[model samples]
Target: MSSPTSVLLAGGGSAGHVSPLLALADTLTRRHPDLVVTALGTEEGLEARLIPARGFGLRFVPKVPLPRRPSADLLKLPGRLKAAVDAAGAAIDETGAEVVVGFGGYVSTPAYLAARRRRVPIVIHEQNARPGLANRVGARFTTFVATTFSTTDLPHARRIGMPLRREIATLDRSALRDEALAHFGLATEWPTVLVTGGSLGAKRLNDAFASTVAALSRGGVQVLHVTGQGKTFVPDVPAVGAPYVVVEYADRMELAYAAADLVVARSGANTVCELTTVGLPAVYVPLPIGNGEQRLNAADVVAAGGGLLVDDDALTPHWVETELIPLATDGDRLAVMARASAALGEPAADEQLADLVELAWGTRA
Candidate 1:
C-alpha cells in the first residue's frame, strides 16, 4: 500500500485561527483515515490544548510576536524569529510533511519561512476580510491562498469561506428550535434575540445590551444573553415581567443560534462566519479598537443585506430601543435578512479547503 500523505498545519494564538485549522484538520483526517496530520503552534497559544484534545499530533514553537513599533523588543526580533524558524524546520523534517497549510498567527510566519527553506509546498488560509501581518508575510512564499471573504486582499487569494465544525456546518435550526428554546428556558413562541460578546466578553456589548434589556422585553422579544465568563452588567430599569435569560457562557452555540431570531454581537471573523452560516440576522457592533478588521469582517454581510453594522460608539441603549427593537419585531425584515445570510454562507468550506491543500500537495510532487 502507498504510504499516507503527510501534512503539517500551522496556526494559533486565538480561537479564530485555531478553530479553522482544527476544522480543516478534522476534514482531512475524516476523508482519508490514513492521512498523517500534524499541527505546529506556540506553547502560549490556545492550540497547545485544543489541538491535542482533538486527537492530532502537535509540536510547539516559540511565539515571536512582530513588534509594531521601534522598541527594545524589536531589536531582539531577528534572533527570536530565527530560533522559531529553526524549531519549525526541525518539526517539518521530523514529520516528512509534503505540504504545510497555514492559518495566520505567530506560528504561521515561522512555519511559512521554514517550509519555503525546505522546499515544501505551502498553502495559506486567511480568516478575515483584511489579512493579518503573518499571512501578508507568508503570502510571498506561496501562490496557493484561500480566504473566508472574497474581499480579503492577499496574493492569489481564493474565496473558500471559513472552515466550520461539523455541528455548525450541518445544523438545522428549524429542526432543533423547540429543543433549543427548552435548553435556554425561553418561550417557545416568543421572538428571541441572542446577545454574545465572544468567550471573554465585550464590556461595551455587555453594557449596551444590559441597559436595553427592559426595552427589548417590553417589545415582546425574549433574550438569551451569553455574557462572557465572570462579566456582568445590570440594567438600571426596573424589572418587567419579560423573559431575559442570562448565562456566563454557552457550551452549545448551536442551540443558541437555533433559538434566536436576531443576534447582537461583536463581528469577529469566526462569529460573522458562524452567524451567516446558520442564517441568523445580526446587529454587529465592531470592537472599537484593533486594525479595523472587525468592521471589515462584517461589511460584506451587512452590504449583502444579511445583517446590520453598528459602530461601537453608536450602539447605545437608545439605539437598541429605537432601532433594534423595531427590527427584531419586524418579521418580514428578519426573514429577508436570514435568506441573505444563508446565501452568503459556504457550508462546504472544510471540504473546499482540504481540496486546496491536496492541490498544493500535488503541485509539489
Candidate 2:
C-alpha cells in the first residue's frame, strides 16, 4: 500500500473555485513531490490555462453550464456528459489517478461522474456557504466533503475554512501600513481602504466607491480600488486632490490587503475567508443573487462583530460616510474586528484537504 501518486482535480469558471484547487495542488505537490496532478475541465475555463501553466496536465472535456432558460445548452447535456466521461476516462487511464477531487463548478460535474463510473474514490471541497449547484449534486457521491462554512446541507461535509495562499496566511501586518502604502504608491498617513469585487471585481461595489471617491479623499482617506479590467466606475465627484490608486487590477492582492486599514468587498467565500485569515476589518456587501449565498458567507462574521454587511441596494455615499469611514479610523475598533476576524482563520485548511485527498485516494501510506 503506497500513497496515491496521482490525483484528478476538477474546477474552473471563477477564480473563487479555482484558487482553492490551486492552493491544494501547491500543498499536495510540496507534500509529495512525485504526485501527478491532472485537471479535467473545459478548455474555456481558467483551469484550462492555469492548470497547464502550473505544470499539471489537463484533460479538456466537452461541458457547458445549464442555462437559466431551457436553451440549446440544456438540450445538449446528455451528449456533453458522454463526451466529458469519455475525456475524463481517458485522462484517468493515462495518469492512473487514484482519486478525483471536485472543487465545485460546472467543470466538476463530469469528473465526478467519470470517477463514480470508474469506481474511484471522490472527495469534494465546497467553498461556498451555500453549495453551488454542481457541488450540491456532487456531494451525494463524495466520500468526504470539506467546506469553509460550518452550516451546509451536505451530510458528510466538514467545516474547514477556505484554503488561502501561504503568503496571505502569513501576511505581516506590522509592516502593513507602510508596506501596503508603498506597494500601491499611496500616502501612509491616510486611512487606506481596499475595495475589490472578489476575484472578478464587483461593479456595484465599484460604482458606490466611485461615487464617494472624492468625498473619501477630502475626508483624509486614501483608496486602493481594484476595478476589474474592462469595467467602468463613474465618480460622482471628481478626484480633486492627489489621485487615489485607481487600478483595473492589482496582481499582488496580498499587498492590497496588507496596505488597507479596512476593506469593502463582495462576501464571496474566498474573500471572506482571506479577510478572516489576514485579520482585516471589512464592510462586506454580498452579491444579492443566487439564493443569497454571499450574504450567508458574511453573516457569521457580521453577527460575531468581525465585519459589517451592506446590501447592494443600501450601498450609498451616505452609508459609506456614516458607517465605513468611522470604522476605518477607529484604531481600537479596527483592532477588535481584526482580532475577531483572525479568530476565524483555519490555516491548516490545505493540509486538511490533503488528508481528505489521501483518504479518497485510498492510500494507507
- The ten-residue window of minimal lDDT in model 2 covers 234-243
Residue-wise lDDT of candidate 1 within 247-345, one digit each (tens)?
889999999999999999999999999999999999999999989999999999999999999999998889989888889889999999999999989
Candidate 2 global Cα RMSD:
2.5
For model 2, how does the per-residue alpha-carbon lDDT over 59-120 read when each residue is reduced to its tens digit? 87776667788877888878877877788788877889888898888778888888888888
Alpha carbon lDDT at 163, candidate 2:
79
Task: List lDDT for all candidates, in order.
Answer: 0.91, 0.82
Cα lDDT for residue 93, candidate 2: 79
TM-score of 2: 0.92
Off by over 4 Å in 1: 1-4, 233-241
